[model samples]
Target: MKRLLPLLAVFAPAPAFAHAFLKSAEPSVGAVVATPPAQLLLTYTEGLEVPFCTVTVAGPDGAQVQTAKPQPVPGHENELAVPMHITAPGKYVVTWHALSQDTHKTQGSFSFTVSP
Candidate 1:
């Protein structure tokens, strides 16, 4: 019974490590489209604390196209939207970094193609 008590104590707080993950996106990744999207949206599995997220768009030639800042969606703690102004036709990569409510930082990238 003594050994079992120690094992139970160790497993008591095992649920605190649940990490956040990307849940969805607007103009979804790898999507090919004919027109430029007004904004880029990213949704997370969990709510962010500070909501300091950034999204950068790079054109096919590796040149940045959009410079607008990312804005957090009102009433939605796990979603963010960033304005876009894509001028060239090619592959564009959207990279994002966000801090979760637990003070853990997460980042990832996705790509989409703009038809010429």
Candidate 2:
């Protein structure tokens, strides 16, 4: 019985980790696009805690770009769409922070270039 108890405890199913991680992004990481994307699209590995998530866009000179608040993509709680603007040819950096429904938080940054 003692052996069984210890064995059961050791082999018990573990809780699954549900951290929100960037799965993929539009304008793709380090991509050079002929046209600037109207919005930044981010897909995450888990459903997000919308109120706790944020996305920011910055221009080549590290100036903040005016952007609308991030919102859940229609029919997709795991995706957030953030409106952005890039008026001239330059590199843009996007930084995002997400809090998953599991309460885990994750943040990351990536850059993309706009060509003339």
Candidate 3:
């Protein structure tokens, strides 16, 4: 039994470390809304490098949406947001890349719909 226990210990999962994990989004990732949002918001699980974070928004037509640079909230390094110019009701794709204070890089994308 001791031998089995030692072997099992070697295969056990390692402890998790901090990373800039996408915890949630303002549009709620894959949500459909009745109106277009004037901005994009992303919350991470760890403090992020504001200068290294980036966000890109695109419409279903494949043209990029005019968005201001992403900025971390003043008191919340884990949150990022950008001003968006939403014109019409349609699908919008939001893509973001983040660099945590620990130097870990993470990225993801999702789409949401805007209906009148």
Candidate 2 is scored at a TM of 0.84
lDDT of 1 by residue, 1-116 (tens): 88899889987876565555678888798999899888888888888753476678888888876667778788998888888888888899988888877777889999999899
Order of the predicted models by TM-score, top scorer first? 2, 3, 1
Model 2 agreement with the true structure over 1-116: per-residue lDDT tens digits: 77799899899888576789899999899999999788989999999988789989898888877378888887899999888877878998889999999888999999889898
Evaluate all candidate structures by whole-model CA lDDT and list the values in order: 0.81, 0.88, 0.87
Better of 1 and 2 by TM-score: 2
**Candidate 3 Cα outliers beyond 4 Å, as residue runs:** 1-15
TM-scores for every predicted model = 0.79, 0.84, 0.83
Q: Lowest lDDT 10-mer window, candidate 3? A: 63-72
- Model 1, runs deviating above 4 Å: 1-17
lDDT of 1 at 6: 83
Which residue pairs of candidate 2 clash?
none
Superposition error at 67 for model 2 (Å): 1.5
Error of 1 at 29 (Å): 1.2
User: How far in Å is the alpha carbon of 93 misplaced in model 1?
Assistant: 0.6
